[model samples]
Target: MATDLRVSLTDRCNLRCTYCMPEAGLQWLAKPDLLTDDEVVRLVRIAVTQLGVTEVRFTGGEPLLRPGLPGVLERCAALRPRPRISLTTNGIGLHRTAKTLRTAGLDRVNVSLDTLRPEVFRTLTRRDRHRDVLEGLAAAHAAGLTPVKVNTVLMPGLNADEAPELLAWALDLGYQLRFIEQMPLDAQHGWRREELVTAEDILRRLGERFTLTPEGSARRGSAPAERWLVDGGPGTVGVIASVTRPFCRACDRTRLTADGQVRNCLFAREETDLRTALRSGEPDEALADLWRAAMWGKKASPDLDAPAFVQPDRPMSAIGG
Candidate 1:
């Protein structure tokens, strides 16, 4: 059963992160083609009421780019057995919107921060919004977004050496930091297995600074990050390890693009067009059936380790990472 749904609010992003997109010439979806606030609410209602979805995460090229996001959060909060609402963002705009989003019933947030150094941040993202991201982290904590996670994608020669420093910074500020193994979702399609910084390498580096203990088998089902206690303290750090250690067996999440397509997996080659069905006056129960059937046919796992593994056509930004 698909108990979680990642809803892409828009495909328009402000930053040109190296892994997500090129610096320019990106084609964005037209306003009319994207789902309206009411349409998103309707699909979410069906997912929660019929399909037993208990969590809904708002993702995007940048979800904060959507003007009506707070209203969408409010509507999702009104549902019976209100699902947990979260957002995955770049944190560039959170400084201005975090309080409003929290007040509108957002439960938590995960912000993407790849590096702490200003120069490296500029090199990776092609933007100088490092100070803005730091402020956004502070604002999120002030707004009471518990467990404000910082997601850092570890590149082999870039920012990989800062693993311990990044964890210490997050720990000092009472935030959870997760180092993600780079997957083949870049716009350039230049990813290679040898370039990945594995979880074992990260743990080893982190262990040199802090006393760490694995939180083995206590992780929540379907949760992507494997956690570790930091120095027997309150803070914890996580490693996604997507490339080295695939977690597809217990995956229970599905995705809804801003254009209304249903994606069963992040790496799925095919998508079901739910927007057309929704616009064609299909009954709510029928739409629910379509969603369930789509997820039911999902493959046991995405073959990321196969020698013939091919990168998906859409990059991470378009896929709502």
Candidate 2:
């Protein structure tokens, strides 16, 4: 059963990350097409009350961009057997809203920070908001958002060499760092396996700097990240090797786009339009049935290595990475 749900609060982003969306002048979804705060809350309620969802992760081009975010968090927190709420953001505007979000019952956050170097940050994200991200991290920590995770996408000949530096930086700030293998979700759809930095390479490089050991089975469950103990100590690091080591078998999460489409997998080419049903006056149980049936029919695993593997029509931004 799908126990986790990722909801894309919005499809608009401030930064144009190279790995995601590099070009400008991209057309965004119409405001009216996006789900309202009530619609999102209703969906979460159905998932929690009917579908056995225990975790709800809010994602977006940047989730913080949604003005009604805190209210949405509040509504989700009110659900019976209240689901654990988390968010994934770029950290650009987090500095101003982290505390508010936390107060609104947000449990944790995962911020995308590829590099510490300002020049490289600008080059990778097409924006010079490195300072903002740093400030956001500090603010999140200060707000008592424990286990603030930093997600770094590994790219060959780019930020790959900064693994040690990035780990140290995160460790210094008492934050967990996770390196993710680049997937085929780029807006440009130019993903190539040759350009990816595998988890094996990441472990080799980080192992040289720190004494690392694989995490126990307790910590290595359905999570995509293969966790490791840093120096056999308190802190940990993880690698979501989606390309090198796909974890589709244990995948228990489904995604709902801001435009109200239900996706069973990140790389899924097919999507069920829930907005039509919801707008057509479908009852809550019926909506939940749609979700359950959709997930039940999900592929056993995404064929990322297939010769005919085609990128999804929607990019990472629109798909709620």
Candidate 3:
């Protein structure tokens, strides 16, 4: 129930998803600017021991792009609190390494899959790796990662029609599918705010075809999705309507960028750098100060409580979702 830790493993990604990065090109952050594997693990240990963190999730432009990911997972799994260690990936690198990661101590995985159509998939993600993502999902399932989740960013004009098909597909495969309402988080924003599609519209369309029942779930700790179970599916589906129904009041997680900066809110204009203190060799007290500052900066959330809200200058890729 305390603060959760989100450690970004890398700033690089294989796919040039239009929503995340511009097609022109991406300038890689200097390696020295990012946390090394050992440093990241060390910080996670400090977070668990000193910051009352009970859960940890690995995120990134693509966390799997980071070398020694399995090794990092092992260290994080050793936390005394036994935090639920998870990872979010686009699944490009997960086809075969999925099980290896599980053996290394990953609890679960959330894969981003927006379109089921091959053409549309490539168009949206700007990569023709839809097949790889599907394989990754199966590999993840075989690895015993409980409740494998599929995160779909519902774009009105693009992937919206695929919503029902996507949901039904997830149901058949026993994967928990979540449809997230688009927010203005992309760094290279061509996001059409007028394209906003509310969660009600999505559910209303789906409910007409199948029954849905509100299933009680953990309303605590950064509840991005409103929980609900379909009447006859193998698993449930969630809808994260941040634009329509802000759950900011219950926000409980703070983001730690790969560069060792603490982002109190992804929408916040400011971020506190922890890399300097972490490397200062004053490990104990310095870490305490970083955690203390991050904890105090934790808000229920940013005040972007309306559809008219414009996001500040942080890319969703950099923010680690």
Off by over 4 Å in 2: none
Candidate 1, residue 43: lDDT: 98
Candidate 2 TM-score, C-alpha based:
0.98
Please give me the total number of clashing residue pairs in predicted model 3.
Answer: 0
**Model 1: per-residue Cα lDDT over 84-142, one tens digit each:** 99999999989999999999999999999999999999999999999999999999999
Give, for candidate 2, the lowest lDDT window spanning 10 residues: 299-308
Best-matching candidate per lDDT: 2
Q: Which candidate tops TM-score?
A: 2
Judge candidate 3 against the unseen true structure and give its global Cα lDDT, from 0 to 1: 0.81
> In candidate 3, what residue range of length 10 has the lowest lDDT sum?
299-308
Question: TM-score rank, highest first?
Answer: 2, 1, 3
Candidate 1 has its poorest 10 consecutive residues by lDDT at: 213-222
List where candidate 3 sits over 4 angstroms from the true fold. 217-222, 232-234, 305-310
lDDT of each: 0.90, 0.91, 0.81
Which lDDT tens digits does candidate 3 get at residues 230-262? 885436779988877887776777788988888
Q: For every model shown, what is its TM-score relative to the native structure?
A: 0.97, 0.98, 0.94
Screening candidate 2 with a backbone cut-off below 3 angstroms (N, C-alpha, C), the clashing residue pairs are none
